[model samples]
Target: EHGRGPCDCAEFLVTLVERLTQRIERHWNGIDDLADDLEEAVLDEAGPEVGATLVDLRRQAIILRRYLQPQRDALRALQTGQPAWLESDDQRHLAEELDALERVVEDADAMRERMALVRDELNGQASERLNRNMYLLSILSAVFLPLGFLTGLFGINVAGLPGTGEPLAFWIFVGALVIVAALQLAVLRRMRWI
Candidate 1:
C-alpha cells in the first residue's frame, strides 16, 4: 500500500517485514523437524524410506536457499535505507527482520549438509551389505565347483569307464564323492575360505 507520509511508509514496511519474517520462520521450523526425523532414521535403522525422504528434503533446502538468498539481500538493502525513504527507527526494525531472514538461510544451508551426510552414510551401508552378499555367493560357488566337475566327468560316456560295469560301482563312486567333499571342506577351512 502506498503511504500518505514518511511515518505511514515506515509503519507499512515494518509490518510487512515482520509478516515475512514470521512466514520464513514457520517454513524453517518445518524443515528443522524433518531434519530431526531424517537424522534419527539415518542413525537408528536401515530406514529404507529415508533415502527418498532425504532426496525430497535436500531438494527443498536447495530451493529455499535459492529463493531466500535474494530476498535476504533485498531486506538488507531495505535495512540500510537504500531507497532513501525509510526512517532510522524503521531501518532498525527492518534490520531485525533481516537478521531473522539471514538465520533462515543459514538453517537451510545446514539442513542441506545434514541431508547430504545422511545420504552418504546410507550409501555406505548399502555398499557394505552388497559386498557381504557377494562374498557369501562367492564362497558357495567355490564349495560347489569341484564337486560339479567330478560328477560331470563321471557322467561322461567312455569305452573304459571304471564304474560302468560293476554292481558296486555306484556305491563306490558315492563314497568317493563324500571323500572329495570332506577334503574340499578341510582345504577351505585351512585357507579360511569358508
Candidate 2:
C-alpha cells in the first residue's frame, strides 16, 4: 500500500528487467537456431546464405549490446538506491533485476562472438571448396592440353602428312592417340595428380 515511492520504483525496475530478460532469451534462442542452420549448411557445402544469416545475427547482437549496456548501468544504480527511494526489500529486488540485466549483456557478447566464429568457419569452408574445384580444373586442363595440341597439329590440312598416304594410317594414328592418352593417365596416377 506504499504509494508512488520506493516500492513503486522497485516494482517498475523489476518488471522492466524481467521483460528485458525474456526478450534477450528469445533472441538468444533465435541465434542458436540460426547457428545450427549455419553449421549444417557449412558441412553440406551449401552456398553463402548461411553467411548472411550469421551477419544478421551479429548485427542483432551488436544492437542488443548497445541497448543493454546502459540499461544494465541504470539497473545497477537502482540497486544502489542513489535516490534513496528504495527500501531494503526494494533494494533486493533491484539487485536481482540488475543481475538479470548483467546476464543479458553477457549473453549478447557471447552471441556476438559465436556469430563471428560461425562466419569465419563459413569463410574457410568456402575458400576450401573453391580451392578444390580450381585444383580439379587445373588437373583436367593439364591432361587435355597435350591431347588438344596433338590433334590440332595433325588435323591441319597439309599436302604431305606422314600418315595420310596409307590405308592403315588412320588405325595407326588412332592407336598412337590411345597410347598417348594412356601414358598421360599413368603419369598422372604416378604423380597422384588425379
Candidate 3:
C-alpha cells in the first residue's frame, strides 16, 4: 500500500543497500569453499592443510560472486541511461554501492592471485626441505657404510686381533663401534650436517 505521507526515501535506500552489502561481505570477503559433502570430499582429495585454506577461499569467492550478480544487475538498472530499478535520488545511493562492489570484486580477484602465489611458495619450500633431508641421509649413509662393513667383517671370530678368542673381544668391538660412531657424530656436528 502507498503511504499517505512521503516515505524517508533516502534512509530506506541507504539501509537497503547497506544491509545487502553487509550480507554480501559476510559471505564474499574471502574465497568460499562450501562445506558440503562434495566440498569435503574435494578437500580430502586436495590434502588437509593447504586444502582447507583453499576450500575456504573458494567458498567465500563463490558466495560473493553469487550475491554480486544481483547487485551488478541493480547497478546496471540504476545506470544513467536506464534509471529503472530506482529513481534519480535512489540511484545516488546505488551508484556508490556499485562502486564499492566493484572494488570488492577486484579485491577478491587479488586474494585469489595471492593464495595461488602462497601455494606455489609453500610447494617450493616443501620440496627444498625434502631435498635437504635426503641429502643429509645420503651423507650419513656414505659415512657409515664402510664403517659398518669393517666392523661386521672384523667382529667375526675367524681370525685374531687383540682378543679375538677371548670373551672380552665382544666388548672390545662394541667399544670400537662406539668410538667410530662418536667420530662420525663429531664430524657431522662440525660440518653442521645435523
Mind giving the per-residue lDDT tens digits that candidate 2 earns over 1-194? 75754347656766666777778778767876776777677778777676677788788878978988888888776656556665676677667767777776787888878777777777788788899999999888877888889888889998788878899987888788788888998998899888
Q: Lowest summed-lDDT stretch of 10 residues in model 2? A: 2-11
Ranking the candidates on lDDT from highest down gives 1, 2, 3
Write out the backbone clash pairs for model 1.
Answer: none
Better of 1 and 3 by lDDT: 1
TM-score of 2: 0.85
TM-score of each: 0.84, 0.85, 0.62
Please list the C-alpha lDDT of all candidates, in the order they appear: 0.84, 0.78, 0.67
* Residue runs of model 1 more than 4 Å from their true location after superposition: 1-7, 82-84
Alpha carbon deviation, residue 159, candidate 2 (Å)? 2.2
Give one digit per residue, the lDDT tens place, for model 3 in 1-194.
65643366655766778778777666553233332343454434444466566556755666666667777776666575643545677767777788878777776666666566655655666677789899988887967886789787886668556676599877877888778888888888899887
Q: What count of clashes does model 1 give?
A: 0
Stretches off by above 4 angstroms in model 3 are 1-19, 29-50, 66-74, 77-80, 84-86, 128-136, 139-143, 155-163
